[model samples]
Target: MGIYGFDLLIAGLCLLFKQITQLSYVFSFILLFLSGSVIPFENLPEIVRKIGLMLPLTQGVLLGKKIVFEDLSMSAATGSSDFLWLVISSLVYLTLGVLGYKKCEKIAKEKGILSHY
Candidate 1:
């Protein structure tokens, strides 16, 4: 689940930076793997842990692990409330990525960088 959201973010970024090297997919894969195995947020310091929690991958991994390890029922694992939160987080990321990309494009256009396109 976390990987899914992370993939979405990376895909979005790739779309927004199509002219640049397409590394988001690989980067997201590495990040997702790290999120799951290397530095589980539980092992992080307080502030770093909080920052980790804000990441979509973290939320997805936590929810997924709870379901897989604890035998939590789907209803329990993806309760309406919890699902809504996931949706909200995804939407927020999507919105921010799109707006930021648009702003960058606008700046590039104003600076004539976009003329080459």
Candidate 2:
């Protein structure tokens, strides 16, 4: 799940780069590590932990680990409200990423930064 989310973020950032500067491979790597690390959220300072929990990648990694390691049945995995929230978060990330890319593209066009392709 971490890998999947990392790939998605990379794809999104790449798509967004034409419109935004300071977004590069290093930033993507940092975000990916933040999402995949297993340090307990509660062990972190409160504000940082809250920010971590709000990240979609974190949610994906947690829920993905549960689904992969547990003996939960399909219904138990998908029917639970918590899992539903994870699904929603994943969708939200995907949708927002795409929309952000589009918005950035528009801004780049206005700023005459778009590359001919």
Candidate 3:
């Protein structure tokens, strides 16, 4: 779900932004770097950690870590509030991404920028 939302959001951005390629490429790398994949989230500043957890992918990654190291089952995690927040956040991103894509698609088509892109 995190992957789906993140991909949709980026795809929507590619259609909406003028600097499509660079925005998608550079932003993805930055997202990955801040996702706590390379750095333990515990090592980050409190504010940074909080912000990262708000993003879908970062929360999913942390959930996966909990499952692996804490011996938590997928079913058990579903019962936890943290896991619920992760799902809700992913759904929020999904909704925004889909809406942004539809709106941008209409604008791009009218402006004749769809094919130019």
Q: What tens digits encode model 1's per-residue C-alpha lDDT throughout 1-117?
A: 434544454544444455544486467555555455466657767876666666666666777777888888888767756566666776776676666656666666676665453
* lDDT, ranked from best to worst: 3, 1, 2
Candidate 2, pairs of clashing residues: none
User: Runs in model 2 with CA error above 4 Å?
Assistant: 1-22, 36-42
The better-scoring model by TM-score among 1 and 2 is: 1
For model 3, how does the per-residue alpha-carbon lDDT over 31-63 read when each residue is reduced to its tens digit? 676678878888888888877887888888888
Q: Is candidate 2 or candidate 3 better by TM-score?
A: 3
Error of 3 at 89 (Å): 0.2
lDDT of 2 by residue, 6-70 (tens): 45555545544644235555665556555656464446567666666666776666666778778
